[model samples]
Target: MKIQNKRLFASILFVLISVLCVAQGPPYPGGGPPGPPGFPIDGGILMGVGVALFYGVKKILGNK
Candidate 1:
């Protein structure tokens, strides 16, 4: 019971800290994503899809 209580306290503390940090984020400008002009809008999305596909193919082929 003591171990469970400690874990619960840690989880609550972590969530409170995360919320506080998010509330203190930098200011947004121009009512758009946080970046300068002409940012690669789909860069992160494309990279994520590419990585997922790569891993899927590797798993299908049993590379390990």
Candidate 2:
């Protein structure tokens, strides 16, 4: 019974918090400024990091 009550309280709190967060809005009254238009470079950076990590681990293991 205690655990059930705790879970119910947590659920209600979560819902209230989420609703309040969504209730707030940006201070701007009109449409925001236009953002940069171009392809994202994050993907390339992620791929490079992945390759580096893979090679580093492989080199550490001394597996050819």
Candidate 3:
């Protein structure tokens, strides 16, 4: 029971940190200043990586 509680706490902390980091990062940098509408390719690549990681974790945990 104690181990389960610790795991849950750690998961929550990890998620909170991930959310904070994402939120602190810049979004659509092009809108912030005079730019060429930001780097769409980079954004797409980042999104792809995020999706891959999400599914990879799910698969590894046998959650899917």
Candidate 4:
């Protein structure tokens, strides 16, 4: 068979397989979906600010 025909057949098979995969809806923990995930920038934000401040001070002082 030609390469083009092979590629076309592959594409069709892939699409059909993907459709079968999602045929059943997703399962929920309870009766409905859960709430949004939490934002985890609690201590990381302070660390990032400290690093930026240290870098800025070093640049201002012309440190090597």
Q: What would the TM-scores of all predictions be?
A: 0.41, 0.50, 0.39, 0.41
The best-first sequence of candidates by lDDT reads 4, 2, 1, 3
Tens-digit per-residue lDDT, 1-64, candidate 1 = 6999999999999999999998874666654466577766688999999999999999989965
Residues 1-64, candidate 2: write the lDDT tens digits.
6999999999999999999997988656674655678867788899999999999999989965
Worst 10 residues of 2 by lDDT: 26-35
Candidate number that wins on lDDT, 1 or 4: 4
After TM-score superposition, the amount by which residue 63's alpha carbon in candidate 1 deviates from its true location, in angstroms, is 8.1
Comparing 1 and 3 on lDDT, the stronger one:
1
Pairs with steric clashes in candidate 2: none
Q: TM-score: which is higher, 3 or 4? A: 4
**Rank list by TM-score:** 2, 4, 1, 3
Best by TM-score: 2
| Best candidate according to lDDT | 4
Greater lDDT among 3 and 4 belongs to 4
Q: Write the per-residue lDDT of candidate 3 for residues 1-64, one digit (tens) a residue.
A: 6999999999999999999997774565754645586556768888999999999998999964
In TM-score terms, candidate 2 sits at 0.50
lDDT against the true structure, per candidate, is 0.86, 0.88, 0.84, 0.89
